[model samples]
Every structure is written in structure tokens, then in C-alpha cells.
Target: MTVQEFIEFKIISFGDYFVTPLHIMQMVILIIVSWTIILISKQVVQRQINSGRFDKGRGKALFQILNYSIIVLTIIAGLDMVGVKITLLLAGSAALLVGVGLGLQQVFNDIVSGILLLFEGTVTVGDIIELNNIVGKVEKISIRTSKIETRDGIVIIVPNSKLVSDNVINWSHNRSVTRFRIKVGVAYGSDVSLVMKLLSDSALEHPEVVRTPEPKARFIDFGESSLDFELLFYSKRMFDIEFVRSDIRVKIDQKFRENNITIPFPQRDLHFKTSDTFSIDKTK
Candidate 1:
């Protein structure tokens, strides 16, 4: 048979729909062209993002939208080539779609939340955030979920809906430096001035700590057995802040030991009153 006649030969026929070799060729070509377009577009977008022309997160979001649109269009074109009527297909599946939508309500919610995150630019890549008391850095955000890498180097998948609905603390938002505190209790008789000085000096000595804002020591309150003091300092290293805090604590301990400032433990005094009703058994 001639090539044109072979191309027109139907492979499968069902009522009003049929598939031909021409249709198969068209679908293959469409997929190849669509893939090429997306690959090229992705490279262009990446260059723009790397050049700092726009925010990285927003650029990624824009690319995602474009990519999804292309895939949808490719699907429509493939279906059309295979003699499938898009409108008729949608009309026939309307009821089925409704049922599926109801069952996947939370999935739809997450998709919407992801869109909001991409558009709002509130939560972006590389941001140190605390959600549900689990602190991590945002690595990626997709249509239904986000990838976060915790301090322990563990990657966790979180639903986007939770990100939108929960109270999340974005530490690296707007400001690079975040303030942290370390609490210490000293013996009551320890010189308050000396304690404050030691706390401030220890924080100041750390290279990670910000000096412009200046670390300060606050005499919070007088406890039952010791004087409570808090050392507050700001640092740009939010991801590994625990390490900074540890180093500062080490410094503070060294300073306190050198100055003879004792970190007192909780102490309680008890007085015994001999009474007929509450007598202790001397021999048991």
C-alpha cells in the first residue's frame, strides 16, 4: 500500500472513533516538540533566575505554570488527533469529576495553597521556618507539597495546606539576623554587674554574633535560689544557630568559672516540727 494510504489505515475502530498510524505519528511529534519547548524554556528561565533579574522562587513558579500549561495543551492535542472530542468527554465525565473532587478536597486545597505561596512570595526557597515546632529550611515548593531540610540533614515532605494554615515562623524573612536567648541562673550573692558583663562579653567574642545591634544581658528576675539572667544576641546564621548558642554558652561558662561566678542549683530548706500527730518511727 502507498504511504498515504497506509497512514490513513485505521488500527482500531469503535462506533464513531478510530485510531490511525497518522494519529500515532502526530502524537509522537507533538510530545517531542512539547518536550523540546519545555526544555528550552526551562534553561531560559534558569538563566534569568541566576542573573538576579527576578526572585528565584517566583521565577520557578512562573516556569511551573508554563510547564503545566504546555503539558495540558499537549494532552488536548493528542486526544484531538486520536478523534476524541474534548467537550463531549468532559460532559460525559462531569458527574465522575464531581465525586473525585469531593474525595480529593484536601488535595485541591493543597494545590491552591501552593499557588498562594508561589504568588505571595511569603515562603520561599532557603528560608528558615518553624512549622509545628519542627524547624527546617525550605528546599523546594511544588503544586501540592514542599520539601524542607531540617538541621539534622533530614528532608521532610510537608503539605502546602499546612504551610498556609499553620502559624509558621520565617526566621530568614526580610531580616538576615535573628535574635536568640540563653538563660542562666547565678548564685544570689554573685555580682550582678559581673554576671552581666560576662554574658555580654561572651556573646561579643563570638564572630557569628552581630555587633551593630550588640548583645545585651537582662536581669530577668530573682528566683528562689538564684538570680535569673538572659543573654540575647543576634546572628545571621539561622540554620545552624544552635551551634552558635552552644559556642556562646561555652564562652559564658569559661568566663563564669574564671570570675568565680557560680551557676547555682535549685535549693530548698526544710524545718521539722515535732508533733504528736506526725511522729517519725525511730525503729521500723
Candidate 2:
């Protein structure tokens, strides 16, 4: 057979679809070109991130959008090369997609949530967030789910929909520093002024705690057992605030010990009333 005939010799044919040596070569070339484009895009994104041209979060979101767009475009191009009409294909699958959408409503919600999260820039990778009482640092934000790494070193995969629909506290959202409070109770009748000073000193001693706000000690309430005082402070280490608080507590406890300040526990007094039918015996 001639070279042209061999190139056009159909290896497989089904209805309107046919695969030949020429088609295989074209498919291979298309795949290689698509892969090269994706790689170049990734490199460009990495350079942008490293150069600090934009905020890391915003850059990452842009990169993801671009990457996905490229993949979609490449897929459409590949299908077109293989004699598949993009519009017609989508229209043909419209009813099937509708049926699938009903069953996969939650999955679709997560996808939309992911998109919103990227575009709105509400929650992003490396953000410290609280959801469902679980406080963790966002390790990754993907199309459908997010990976959160807690203080205990546990990584949890959370659905993106929960983040968008539910109430999530983004500690690192608007500000890098967040204010936190540690509640301390001392024995009643103890020196209130001294307690306040000690609490403030303990907070100020921590390196992570900010000083501009000037660690505050507030007399919040008079509890049943002791005098309730709250030590309020600001720190930039939202994810590691627990550790910072623990260090402050340790310092507070040591200072209190040295100052002979007593922390009280709950104490209750019970009295028994004796009636005519029930009298206490003196000698038993």
C-alpha cells in the first residue's frame, strides 16, 4: 500500500466514528501540546506567587481557575478533533445531567461553594478557621473539599459547602491578629488589684501576645466560688493561640504561687433540719 493509503487505513470504525494512523498521530500531538501548555501555566503561577505580585490566597485561586479552564478547553478541542460537536454533545446529555443533578445536588453545592470561596476570597489555604467547633489551619482548598490541619496534627477533609453555607469563623480573614481571652478565678477576698496586675503581666510576658492593645484584665463577674476575671490579649498566632494561652497560664500560675494567691474551688454548705419525728441522737 502507498504511504497515503497506509496513513488513512482505518483501524477501527463505528457508525460515524473512525480511528486511523493519522487520527492517532493527531491525538498524540494534541495531548502533548495540551500538557506543555498546562506545565507552562503552572510555572507562571508559581513565579507569580514567589514574586509576591498578588496575595498568596488570591494568586492560588487564580491559578486554580486558569488550570481548570485550560483543562476544559483542551478537552473540548480534543473532542472536536475527534469529530464530536461540543454544543450538540452537551445538548444531548442535558436530560441525563438533569437527572444526575437531582441525585448529586450536594456534590453540585460543594462545587459551587468551592467556586464562591475562590472568587469571594472568604476562606483560602493557610487560613485559620473554626467550623463545627473544630479549629484548624486550612491546608488546601480543592474543587469539592478542603483539608484542615488541626493543632493536634490531624488533617480533616471538610466539604466546601459546609464552609460556604454554615457559619465559619475565619480568624485570619480581615486581620492577622485576633483577640482572645483566658478566664481566671481567684479566691474571694483576694486582692483584686493584685490579681488584675498579675493577669496583665502574665499576658504581656508572652512573646506572641501583642503589646499595643496592652493586655487587659477585666473583672467579668462574681462567680459562686471565686472572683471571675478575664485576661484579654491579642496575638497574631491564631492557629497556635492555644499554646500561647497555655504558656500564659503557666506564668500566671507561677506568679500566683509566689504571691500566695489562692484559686478557689466550688464549696457548698448543707444544713439538716430536725423535726419532731426525726431527732438526732447525741450518744450513738
Candidate 3:
């Protein structure tokens, strides 16, 4: 048989739709071309990202969108080449799709939310975020969920809908540095001026602390048994903030001890109204 006759030989048939060697070959070629386009697009996008011509998160998101679009178009073209009526097929599956959509409402919601996240750029990879009291750095964002690596190095997958519908704190969104405060109370009658100076100095001693904003010591209030003071400092380390705070606390403790500034414990005074009541308790 000639090559053209062999290529046109029908391999499968169903109603008006039929698959032939020619159709299969065409699909193979189409897929190869589509894959080449996707690869080239990825390379271009990565180059732009590397060159700082595009934001990494947004660029990746855009590339994924383009890749998926191309694949979908390729599928439609291949089906058409095989004599599959795209419009009729969709019409036939309309009822089934509705049923599936209803059953998978949350899944659909998450998928849509994922698309929103990628488009809006509100939440992205490498951002330090806090949700449901859990703080972590986003490692990946996909169509249905996101992966977050916590401060403890535990990775957690969070549904995209939750990120969109719930309140989230993005520490690295507006700026790199975030201000954190440590509250400490000194023993009553301890030199307030000395306490403030110590708090400021201890925070400044930390290398991670920002110097341009300058560490601040606020004499917040007078507690029942101590003088409350707050030490505020800015740092670029959001994920490791707990360690930074701990280091500052250690420094504050050492400084307070060296300066004889005591952190007083909670104190409560009791008054004895009658000795008779105490004697009754002893008898019982």
C-alpha cells in the first residue's frame, strides 16, 4: 500500500467519529509542536524572571496560565482532526458536568481561588504569612493548594480557598522590615531611666536589628509590682523572628542583671481581719 493509503486507514470508529493513522500522526506532530512552544515560553519567562524584568511569582503564574491554554487548544485541535464534534460532545456532557460541579463545589472554589491568588499577586511564593495562628513561609502555590514551610521546618499544605476567604497576615508584603516589640517589667523603684536605656541598648546590640529606624523604649505603664516597659525594634527576619526576640530577651536579662534592674514577679498583699477565723480553719 502507498504511504497515503496506509496513513488514511481507519483504526477505530464510533458513530460519526473515527480515528485513523493520519489523525494519530497529526496529533503526534501537534503535540510535539505544542510542547516545543511551551518549552520555549518557559525559557523566555525564566530569563525575564532572572533578569528582574518580571516579578518571579507573577511570571511563573503567567507561564502556567499560558502553558495550560496551549495544552487545551492542542487537545481541541486533535479531537477535531479525529472528526470529534467538540460542540456536540460538550452538549452531551452538559448534564454530567453540572452534576460533577455540584458535588465538587469546594474543589472548584479552591481552583478559582488559586487562579485569583496567581492573578492578584496578593499571596505568592516566599512570602512570610500567618493564617489561623500558624506562621510560615510560602514555598509553592498551585491550582488547588499552597505549600508552607513553618518556622520549625514543617511543611503544610493549605487549601487555596482558605487563603482567599480568611484573614491572612503577609509580613513581607509591604516592606522587608517588620517592627516587633518585647515587653518587660522592672521592679518598682528601679531607675526608670536606666531601664529604658538598657532596653534600647540591648536591642541595638543585636546585629539583625535595623539601625536607621532606631530601637525605641517606651515606658508603657506602671504595673502593680513593676514598671512596664516595651522595647520596639525592626528586623528583616520575619520567619526567624522568634529567635530574634529570644536573643533580645536574653540580652535584656543580662543587661538588667548587670545594672541591678530586677524583673519583679506579680505581687499581692493579704490582710488578716480576725485571728478567730484562722483558729477555726486550723481546727477543721
Per-candidate TM-scores read: 0.85, 0.89, 0.91
lDDT of 1 by residue, 127-244 (tens): 8999988899999999899999999999999999988999999998777789999999999899999899999999999999999799999999999999999999999999989999
- Model 1 earns a TM-score of 0.85
lDDT of 2 by residue, 131-244 (tens): 999899998888899899998999999999999999999999867789999998999889999999999999998899999888999999999899999999999989978889
Ranking by TM-score: 3, 2, 1
Tell me the spans in candidate 3 whose CA falls farther than 4 Å from its real position: 275-284
Error of 3 at 70 (Å): 2.5
Writing each residue's lDDT as its tens digit, candidate 3 over 11-74 gives 9988877788888889999999999999999999999999989777778878877887898899
Best by TM-score: 3
Pairs in steric clash, model 1? none
lDDT of 2: 0.90
| Better model by TM-score: candidate 2 vs candidate 3 | 3
Give the higher-TM-score candidate: 1 or 3. 3
